[model samples]
Target: MIIFFFLQSKIFIACVLMNLLIALCCFHFC
Candidate 1:
């Protein structure tokens, strides 16, 4: 149970980081 939650949080953090990176790239390019 704890391991499942840990993995979920890790995935969520990764997704947020990716989104922020994409936004930054768009802002810089446009």
Candidate 2:
């Protein structure tokens, strides 16, 4: 249970970071 929760949180953080990175790249290009 603890490992599952930790993995889920890590994935959520990674997704958020990825989204921010993509948004920044798009804004920079456009």
Q: Per-model C-alpha lDDT, please?
A: 1.00, 1.00
1-30 per-residue lDDT for model 1 (tens digits): 999999999999999999999999999999
- Give the C-alpha lDDT of model 2: 1.00
Q: Which pairs in model 1 have colliding backbones?
A: none
**Best candidate according to TM-score:** 1
Single out the weakest 10-residue window by summed lDDT for candidate 2: 1-10
Q: Pairing residues by index, what is the TM-score of model 1?
A: 0.97
The C-alpha TM-scores of every prediction are 0.97, 0.89
Residue-level lDDT of model 2, residues 1-30, one tens digit each, is 999999999999999999999999999999
- Candidate 2 positional error at 16, Å: 0.4
